[model samples]
Target: MPQWWKEEIVYQIYPKSFQDSNHDGIGDIQGIIQKLDYLKDLGVTMLWICPIYCSPMDDNGYDIADYYQIHPDFGSMEDVDELIVKAKERDIKIIMDLVINHTSDEHAWFQEALKNPDSPYRQYYIFKEGQDNQPPTNWRSVFSGSVWEKVPHEDNMYYFHSFSKKQPDLNWENPQMREDIYRMINWWLDKGIAGFRVDAINFIKKDQSWQNGPVDGADGLSSCFEFTRNQPGIEVFFKELREKTFDIHHCMTVAEAVGVPYDQLSIFIGQDGCFSMMFDFNYSHIDITEHEEWFPLQNWTMQEYKEKLFLSQKEIFKTGWCGTFLENHDMQRSLNRLIRNPQERTPKAAKALGQMFMFLKGTPFIYQGEEIGTINNHRLSIHDFDDLNSHAQYRRALQEGYSEEEALDFVNRRSRDNTRSPMSWNSQLYAGFSDVQPWLTNNEYYQDINVAKQVNDPDSVLSYYKQMIALRQNPLYHQTLVYGDFISLESEEYVIAYMRQDDQQTILCIQNLQNKETHFPLSSKAQVLLSNDQVNIQNQQLKLSPYQATILLIE
Candidate 1:
């Protein structure tokens, strides 16, 4: 609503797996530059590249070793400059991933903090003494083990990490730290980067009391939910951040916010709130269990999924816009996760999901490989796993009286590594991601679902996404899709319908969540704008096929 972001279509690229130009077993900025035309042709207005900063890659690129330098695995600073220039030439805006919540333990500041107790950098990160030889708080690391790790040569003192021990949480309460982060943000904006996808930003602030919450996991440690997550006064930091950096350059920011309450939506993404939009995790959390394990997920019904997604859309429709996405680097494939019936999850189903979200009153994001309807990684042994979270969960599964094979299967379904696999550019070896062995294994079905195979097929999932994106950005419909009022429609079971209404025109979007044919009332004559399956209006009723998604303009 503030500017052009509402009309933008973002495409997320996991740099390490996107494409390897150098064939160094890793993707790089040059590869992205080479594919800029492809993205532009697909109607991608903006690109969100995951962290390519200098890092140890302990948790991929989230653990930054240096904010100013580009990781060698990604490319040189010159390559980044070239990417920005090339992307701009193709009218594609580049959105950097902002991961300021923490830094790698190998970072200079953290290294300095470890060696010198009285150094100014010591206060840059959270470090405190233990109580009775135990950790200050019984908090569990998101990756695994205790959140507190003993600082070498510092008697009984330890540092806290919300994620892996290698990624230590920064002390945002420190004014110098906040100033440094602001400076870094401005530095990137000054370098022609359009905006940022702020990562784990909600966890920047903490309660500081280090009080233990109710133990919820098999381990004695408690989840960070009640203790360190979404503490009071985080808005103060957000406000300053926007004023000092984003506001100056009018940069767009989408935050990876978790645990934010519905009541405070305005503070986080209001007219003048923290970011342009924050990811709504209500639907993403639908599959997790009470013990926070993915093996024994809660039974999720189609009605529940619809209600959850609708609640998010309806809430953000008030003050700000929603950032609608089905899959990202952190989650499983959208179609694979949502459509339980493997037999019914055809290319049509993926297109239906794509159309349903793209037409919604929000900016739609297409993750790499998502356009082609890639599924999750196949069964992986513990030896083949790379993600720290997956390793932790697999170990937990084994401890929960499950066999090794069972644990592997459970982790296979929920591991973030599923999304981290190399992008399938073609049917070639390594799916044309790299000439050498990729950092991770490529999905096996790349032979049938690669971009090279789909780009020419008009009925392919990729082609459908291109059409959906083009339509969303079409001159005649852009205003209606971007600024129109969102109205939830309730007509039939196993169907989610909504309307985007503007003064000039109204568009109706309907999707059949089930794998069976269904019918919905359609009184007036309507024209099919876009649909996954062939459906027509007859006798004042619309016939929908299995997993159908239809958009209609009323006559």
Candidate 2:
């Protein structure tokens, strides 16, 4: 190792929605290989692809079956090896999703467990008889209902699923299971992947007692976060995982940990802990109500938004590195969903969002199409959407007596399917994602925001992202952006501005949040390094025209 990842900009590719090279209507590894040049042109140094492992597709590849085998739908293991080679040739590191929290109910391990209670594989999964007609405990799945699923063969018995019942939670209590996981991690590392993005990692270690979680709502489903978030013994599991897999090879490991508390974060991701970084989900959770329902927002208070962001920054910025993003495969597009004013295309607003997180002393992840200022569509019906979360939420809204129109608005505004829309390669039919039918419908906005048009436009979001990537890697900002301590520039409203300072220099980044003019007072003479605005920065008092962002060089 080179600490390349520490200084790199990662682009996340959700394969199924990325490109369909063979026109198969599904994205495969070969398609990813075909798109390497496109990714290269965008200036991403690392590629973090969602899982391509063999899966049942119950939860869209999260329900893994064989860890060692690539899904046939995605292409062969040879294709994987070839993609790795092709990516490395373009100087891009590749990281695969490591979803070890659970295996699909269809996985051989689970089936074997179901067949014979005495079988060795039974030890790898959680299996117990339901007590008193209720789930073994009240821990609810993050999806909607109880986390436990009763095996058909074993009457009253159940398996834990943090999401879908088809995905059974693995029993980390078994030493044999831990060894197997370590072996698999080594196998992947040995194959030369740069690292892993551990999925639902906080759910791996649970309360061994499987005790009832405290009731936090009227629904009666116990809050899993109370007992499931960063359990007392999870660090040991991660430290062991790090020691056997990451530390040994020193591979980079980032985690999908949403509710990881501030006090326990250092232990979960510090230098000696489980991962190199953990994604900050609080920003995405902004739209969520106290009941975790889709409550429409007339406006996001600039004061409140700034304070919520600062809480995450203040907690993780010092003790541990953070992974920042506006959207991902599991969330709506940032520009389309978060902006109060969608008509502005608000590159300034988008850039300000970027400025808020990118300069926050961490590795920033860019979801595909996000670089092109992708937005979510409000017209797609519930029937047309393929996302499970959207479907579940729609049903819930209907059950709660919301009218069809009312439910549609909430679902459209918040569905993760907004981002799952196919990558717009061109203005062609199907957005050039597939020559055949696509896995998901492309947002009609693709006609204006396709990669073909933006790839050639210097003022495009794609170009701006490339420029920011360059600034972060540039010698001046690399050290300062990565290891420096982040400090928020206290402001009244309309922006989230911050400074990253090391011994050498301090990099100030200002982003405008409102769809109106905003100004930033810079104490020293500053040079505009990067700006979302088409106009040049002339005066020292930063002038931002609605959602404009400027990264500055100040002494």
Q: Largest TM-score belongs to which candidate?
A: 1
Residue-level lDDT of model 2, residues 395-437, one tens digit each, is 7667667888888888888887888888999999999899887
Q: What is the C-alpha RMSD of each candidate to the true structure, in Å?
A: 1.4, 2.2
- C-alpha positional error of residue 490 in candidate 1 after TM-score superposition, expressed in Å: 1.1
Off by over 4 Å in 2: 1-3, 214-220, 289-300, 534-540
lDDT of 1 by residue, 210-329 (tens): 788787666777877666667888889888988999899988899888767788787779777889888888777788764356766568987888888888888877777678888899
List clash counts for every candidate, in order: 0, 3
- What's model 2's lDDT at 73? 84
Give candidate 2's TM-score. 0.94
lDDT of each: 0.86, 0.80
Model 2: ten consecutive residues of lowest lDDT: 290-299
lDDT of 1 at 210: 77
TM-score of each: 0.98, 0.94
